[model samples]
Target: MCVSAALLLLAAVSRVTVAVTLPPHTYQTPYHAQVWSCREVLATLMEQELLGCSFTIISVHDDFSAALTPFLVALMITHSRPYQVVSVGGGDDVRPAWHSTSCDVYVIVAKRLLVLSDLLDTDDDSWDWQGRYLMFTSSSSANDLQRLAVTYKLQKTTDVLFFIRGTSDSELAVYTHKMYSKRSLKLLTLWRDGGFVKMVDLFPNKVNDLRGQQVRVLAVNHAPSVFSIIDHLGLLHNVSGLDVKVVQGLGRALNFTPVFHDPGADLWGSILPNGTATGMVGQVHTDDSEMGIGNVFLTEVRARYITFTVPFDFERACFITPAPRPLPTWMAVSFPFTLNVWILLVGSVLGLTVLVPVFGAGLMVRDYQELHSLSASFLLILAQFSNQSTRRPARTPMQVLVGFIMMCGFVVSVFYSSNLTAFMMVRAVEQPYTSIRQIVQSELQVGGYSDFWLAIFQGSANQDVRSLSQKFFRFDNVTKFLQSIISRQGVLLENTKHLEYLQKTFLTNRVGESSVRLMLEECINPFGVGVMLKRNSPLKSSADTMIQRMREAGLVDKFFKEVLQEARGPATQLSSNTDVGAEGINPLTLQHIQGVFLVLGGGMCAAMLVLVTEKAVAAGKYCL
Candidate 1:
């Protein structure tokens, strides 16, 4: 045991002398000077240009990130800027916090090329990173940078910078991506020649010139918004509408070629139960189309899945009901006066019939024997009211009473004659439904060809709107729906422009008379209508700019008017003899004067019944 201990002591002493003799082993520090250079460049850019901008650092903890993170934190502390650091262990380990944070700039630091690629491959669309500047620190080759830019579809609008660490500690290559050009990778190296660092623009403002790039657009054949003419082969020959014109104007101004595609089967898409969209919205969300434009309205639910441009137009949803029909001939006789006026006239006539007999008896001034009894007095007064000849009274008091009765009867007859003549000539119509409440109370069912019409109002705070939604129905066949409207079976809920289009195109007769008419009360006030695009689309800014300019120039309104006029064409022109009043006054027919004949027949029947009643009374008195 003692010999083993001495040997171990000798080996320890020899190892200590050998370790002391080894010439102070040293290795190069990874990215030592490059880290400092990056800190300096970032400090200058942030202080001078990116003031008040928050930053986010995403790192795969490594030797280089370990060295760079401390310097960045120190710089941020010195400038008193808010910054967050996210350490990624794997692709799935990326924290969702970084995605939701409101950071202006993002710096991704990783050692391996795979790590950087994996970090960028995350499919999170809720975060809007298109407007943010992205800086990548990796040792990947410049070619790899180009591949990443192309693969990730980083457009010129997105500022993507790469800081490539060279073999030596002092060597760092700064590059940016020019997405439209053939050589996408552009070098903007930081020159440090005369003991001072020449500041390089790390994030430069790039003009988003699409450079005649072909962008796919989703659209449908919605008239006035979009009218598509297709050939026999189902190939679209031409397209025209206010929305098409707007898109064409945008294409001209932005120097981009818009290739429109129809979102077949899914006309104007809707959100599904699974929180996914189908139709034009789905196409844009899936990156199959860059934008959608065909009278798409900006709604809160749709806005959650897509981005809408500044509204180029507005939509006023209205109800279209059947036109008021002409009043029946039976009603024309009574239409001259209201129910209350008719009641007052009857009451005054009866009251005078009773008073005339009493007055004749009390004053003892009766010259005619007909004024002695109630029945006889009624007949005499009725005859006077009918403006017929009546027996004259000799006494002054009786004459005065008769004159007053004549004056009242003459005034009422003159007013009734004038009113009846006007009513018969003008063809008065029935009262139409003027409000949504009235429509709800009516037997007419509210419906439209598109579900979107009623879907938008399902969540309304107004009780009337909610009740209307409950009564709403969606029709698949537009022809049937229009027929229902014409037959007064249903009331159509649609945009005002669309309702007008339908009236002019389908509901009008050869003489330009429409069977359907829009309600006076609007169901929904005017709200903005706009184009839809994918969330965080790069085309948003340029498209918005061009649309705003077109609006200012009044081109939008001009396009709308032109489309509507063309749609109307000469098919809906009013004929010269269309209006009855346009020619001479309309002559009365049997349909007009049938009510007067019926009144005469009723009077004859009443006279017969009175004669029978008097005979029965006399028979009973004789039997008694």
Candidate 2:
């Protein structure tokens, strides 16, 4: 008993008394700043009780690792209580090995540095073997180490994982199970001086999510929907080894808090006033005049169910129509040119005949010339109809003839002009119109407002058309009954082809056919289609991060280009003219204002002209 007590005392004394000291360090000039920066930030935050004291660093040594080694040791030693830091060494010729120790004031230095190259040594099972805090400065292998550490939950308490990679794969795997079973591991580049701000903007609430209660995030293949939501909430990777049943079990166990939503537009202030804009609100019965799809909603609520990203490419929508035919020249002139023009000419000629009696031979010759002129005028009128040359009138000819010819030509010109003009008034120029099918087959949905009458017409009547292909929905007025049907109704029609053809032709032939198709089909014109969210929602920021990163990385561009190529490959115009680019957000008033502006301008011009005329008349300029 006495010997055992002595041995126990010796062991306890050894455990409590010895202080590990790292050699006085001279850090590499370039990496010293980052090493020290990590040390200082950790010290400050941890001192404030913001971070746990259990942070650890498992170093892989290269030259750069030597500089970073001292800081890690110093960080471990500075904690108020006993702590641990492990140093591991490996090379191509040597198998990787580790040395671990606990110290009251730990300051053990490593001869090597952590690099990206070391990541290659990791095994699938080794991810959860270590602590959370890791710095890979010396080589390229560090990114993998970081991923493994993150994936397996080895480095659980570290908030910021920094890496200086000579060469590293972006697809680093981390064992998140050790570091944190529940919280997500966010890997971002941290520079030596003060670059955390960049990451802060990208991930503002990351720290908060990490600080939340510990959770078990399971990935299940059996029930993807259930597991996805659970894993997402728990911040767990879908690649985690957990089975589908486990994931579903976890989901079933969790009391998912329901997200509350308010009635309004999304963050961008675009949402159809009709409730269809919001999925949770479900579909609502709306009238044609109410806010249909295409109304802008704020950004907050949208982030709840899905992600929202900026529109990278602009789209255009235009109605192509043939130019109108020009009106006949004669119709454009004075009305008298048609009927009385020739009569006046003839009367003038006859009056001149009276002068012939008084003026003898000279007057008679002039009268005869006048008569000849009339004859020429009459012939010219007839020539126009027969496509013959028009003869000029003589100085003195038959006045009646000249007048008659002029009148006939004027009348003919009027007839031609009026008839053609009237026909043009009703002619509907056939232009190639594109509809939703073309867009759907293309799989490139764009945003726009909804049409109401068309929604009802198509929604209730068409049994064959598949509406899910369209991603955008513009909302207008719809009835509650119809909304219920759209929300809950499903039908399986055997004779779908006939019904579709008839419905389409009937709707397309109507005036405002495009609007009708959108309204009725519910597929054509989705006004408030797509997801919207509140401006300030954290979800928006999260989605924005992924979207922005994906965009900058050129992923979205590739996706759309691929989709467009596939869609246009076939000789089909499946999703043709769907985009009506950036429609203005005026529910009403644009048309009225346009008419008012035109009328006002014309009235103002007329008033100004009348004032000028009155002033000129008062000055006695014209006496006729």
Candidate 3:
């Protein structure tokens, strides 16, 4: 009887177990059964070409997203790329670090469509939506797909793919858009066909041609980079420069129209202390301008705000200051000989004056009475040195001494005359500051129109650059900065090419000589110059490709030379007399010989004073 009870209890337990397992087998949802297949479709999508090797999965805290995150991460790991899964409770809870970390592709899975939209539509620059994005949502309907398309279009997110899950897990709709266009979403294909997943090219060349669309460009009136000609009405008439030519070439190649806008007072913008950008950079940063062109340099700080194309040209930063003034004209008398030579000449004359009297006394020459007194000896020696003959001495020893003096005088006179003539013809100038170190050591205030130039060197590891940054000044008013340079009160820092252009165009005298001169030493090594575009601009790849082709074909350098030639016009010929010889020798003017007359007038005045003093003393003695 106990064995029979045990069998009945075992049968009851078996029936309960069968009832629990039968429901899962009979009412299983297609979604639960085909999750692995959905993963396979995702893996195929990820196999498409990407921008980099980093992968990111962004999802909200929901059952659908949480369940899918592991599968996406597994695929990324299997593909051997760096991967990160970011889980957020809501759109507003997204971390700031996620915005800065660059990823080649982002896989976003959300339970609700609103959550995905909220995450993408964050109204801040902290999150730069660069690279490819693929989105998946459990709320898949025709309207949901359309809403996703609109969201991407509104955000201008071009490199994106949308996966629309249908009622049956086997079917998924894939959609994307052509960049820089206002078209409806393009259907690449459904993910599954006849139980097999089909592969589609997620990212393609959509920006090859912009189809005559207007591209807004921010530009400044910086010469050789960009030149703007305005009419009397203050309207822009035309624009041309090396940078303009490049943009025009791009427009032609890519079939787009470039509409330029001036940043008004911003010019080439700078980053403020508050981390906001101004001018051309600000426009690009805020998406107000598609591109900024005016010899924009590629820097790490700037790269954070905007994207730069491949380098089209190179330039070195240089310091320009007023040209050194000519030395004082009154000092020309001493230009023929150095200080040591003048001292030696005076010493020789005095020595002859003393020795003549001493030698005459020692020789006991009866006919050498002129050399017996100091005054007589001095007059005789002075006459011989002046290349003038006086009464001859009858003594052989005195004649021999006079002949030697004449020979020495002739040699000295010839050298002095030649050097003096040269000095009179050419004006000597003061030594200029040739290097950054010299300018730093000088009292001249070093400055520029923009603080951007100063900021470039502020973080340098080089000691000299660090020292330069400490003394650097910034001027908001360009006119004032230029006036300071012209007035010789400050040194202006700028690019070498622009400085040269300024020297040729504006900073020149009426005679066509440059008023400002560039320092021999550069403030910084040559760096690359490129076009500035908003971060992750659609036109970057195409622009870079076209620029690379132009550089390789030597067209960039050709454009640079052509723009320079056009801006400079005819070469300036310094005014000169045709009577000058082939060696360019100039004749002496009154400006040169005034020093000699000054010395003569002073000597005559001294003589008159001495005569008056003698007469007065004689009168006083008579009275006494």
Highest TM-score, which number?
Answer: 1
Q: Return the TM-score for each candidate structure.
A: 0.76, 0.26, 0.68
Q: lDDT for model 1, on a 0 to 1 scale?
A: 0.71
List per-prediction Cα lDDT, in the order shown. 0.71, 0.34, 0.71
lDDT-based ranking: 3, 1, 2
lDDT for each residue of candidate 3 in 135-167, tens digit (9 for 90 to 100): 777666656656666553333565777776754
- In angstroms, how far off is 253's CA in candidate 1? 5.2
Q: Give the TM-score of candidate 1.
A: 0.76
RMSD of each: 10.0, 22.3, 10.1
Better of 2 and 3 by TM-score: 3
Residue 501 CA error for candidate 1 (Å)? 2.3
Worst 10 residues of 2 by lDDT: 1-10
Native-referenced Cα lDDT, model 2: 0.34
